[model samples]
Target: MTAADFQIDDREGGSVLRLTGDWTTTGLGSGARDLQARLGEGRVTALDVSELGRFDTAGALTLVQATTEALPKDAWASRPEAGRIYAMVETLERQSAPPPRRPDALTRTFAKIGRGVFDIGHEMLLSMAFLGRLTTATGGALRRPGSIRWPAWFSQGERAGLDAMPIVAVTNFFIGAVIAFLGANLLTQFGAGVFTVQLVAVATLRELAVLITAILLAGRSASSFAAEIGSMRMNQEVDAMQVMGVNPFQALVIPRLAAMIIMLPLLTFIGMLAGFLGGMLVTWSQLSYGPSFFIQRISEDPMMGTHLMVGMVKAPVFAVVIAAIGCRQGMSVAGDVESLGRRVTAAVVQAIFAIILLDAVFALIFLELNL
Candidate 1:
């Protein structure tokens, strides 16, 4: 068969190659090689194929191969036909290439941990800035208490506090029971069974109650805060609030921060109570410790009150951490559902890390204080 007739038309600022009639394999290959030479020499910046083109896959592959071999770097190919051909060739090449080597498990885990630490640090810095803004807004509101948005506060409290109680209660109860059981078993072996009461009280009131409650709040309340604020951000509701002469931080963030601040301590208190009860049940049934005996042990323990106070203090700080981290991440969320999910996850993770770190600091302080 005769080769297809074609012509190369050079245009100002670019080059256009027009083809007419059928393109034989020989003609297509030769054309591709010639185009490749021109492209390699930087003589052609753009290729145009708007006229008289009838080409098969072979013809298309010729142009793709030419471009792939000629292009000095990954530059944009503007011609539709060339782009399409390039994409096809790329897909085929990728499929034909060997599978990528997998990283070692330890290496992957450390990489993930490094990323998590970086994310937490970034989130904490942003959270500190958000907290500063919140402090300013709170002081302003205090100057005019009526300026505080009570309705928003109540709504957020209902969502973040009341809605989260069941899970928090269950988790705290189980944690308390587990700690009590473990402590009783170990202490009983050493003939220190009576001290189990003190152990349960100190562990639950000073550490487990605060730690478990903070974790639950981080996962539930903090994530919820991030998601809610992120959704508002994604929907441009935050921007709309600004346009309506309302501060987005005041209207969107203040209420959440307030709700969490007020609610988390209450939640922690409730969790402590539930956990104590769970421990009491274990003590009575498993350890033969009566209610009076347990009560006496707690009252006689010199550090019991101090432990309780420490846990309560930690609750408020943990609440602030969760709320601040959540709101900061939400405010930073981009306008997409995926970003919302990611920020929410990041908020919870960061809040947990902060809570644990803060708890450790408190533990060290109390230890030094002989409490």
Candidate 2:
């Protein structure tokens, strides 16, 4: 009916606050604090709000605080709504509440680092467990070689090794040629250009061939394996196989692993042959020596056997690591398109990193043994 306003009436026991107009917080005027301070200066007895127009929490609190510690019960019983709120406000103990505080930047930074480390450890543990399962499955299949699934093995071998031949051939050939050219250029100044043949042969056989092949498979075979197995997981086909008393490892994982184990060494040999030819081409063009002389130099090297053995031995190990990571990531996939994509990417990254790490370890071991 009217704009919010109120007045204080001084009384014997305390004060009788009389309200009129709209007594909401918004319209209580700039004098709201002054009125509250004056009301709280001494004792207050009761609030007479019979003439009140509009009332809200702000006005209710103002009326209640104006009253003394021993506010009369009869004063509040008159208006049920405002009285209930004012009574509730009176019981609050402001001193008991504490303010909220935020964590500092350093604390948050350390927390994030701790979480990241924990996630890495957790993932490594999961991958290791999967590797264990695959190892056991491989042994179990060995007892009955028929479980190895020769068709899948042949298919995967063709897919990973044969199908990948063109890229590996072209790339490694150029790499070998580049190495030879660079070596020939450096050695020509000293009349030692022929040594470039031995350099290309030993380095390509001992490191570059297998290393490049493994990296390629990490990207190619790993992503393909993850995608194929992840599709089965997403479609619930893996579950279906389990229900039918079929071991997915025997049917899927073993064949892929077997294929990789057989194929990688053969691929490495092919890469080495192709890379040698490239180096031979470069050496012949630069040093006026044909492939016969290049082959003779490489053949005369005493360490050639050691280099070939070292490189060939690493292939199967790298193959298993890549295939295991790929299969693990695939089987871990959740039944969603996004999860399948994520797992596939993870498979490639994990496989490549593991291969590089394993290769480095092998290098150190061989160096220590003087191989």
Each candidate's root-mean-square deviation in Å?
A: 10.0, 7.2
How well is each residue in 71-155 modelled by candidate 2, as lDDT tens digits? 5657766677766666666666223366667789999899999999999999989988888888888899989876668888899
Residue lDDT tens for model 1, 1-371: 43554455566765544545444355454544575566453344544444434555566555555454332123323345545655676567546768889999999999999999998697568767877888888788889887789999999999888888888888889888898899889999998887777777888898888789889889988888888889989999999888888887778788988898899888888898888888888999988988888788888877777788988989888888888888888899998788998899888898898898998998898789877
How does candidate 1 fare on TM-score?
0.71
Cα displacement (Å) at residue 245, model 2: 0.8
lDDT of 2 at 229: 96
Q: After superposition, how far is residue 229 of candidate 2 from its true place, in Å?
A: 0.8
**Residue pairs that clash (backbone atoms under 3 angstroms), model 1:** none
What is the Å distance of residue 184 in model 2 from its true position? Answer: 1.3
Off by over 4 Å in 1: 1-54, 57-125
Per-residue lDDT of 112 in model 1: 99
lDDT of each: 0.78, 0.84
Any runs in candidate 2 off by more than 4 Å, and if so which? Answer: 1-103
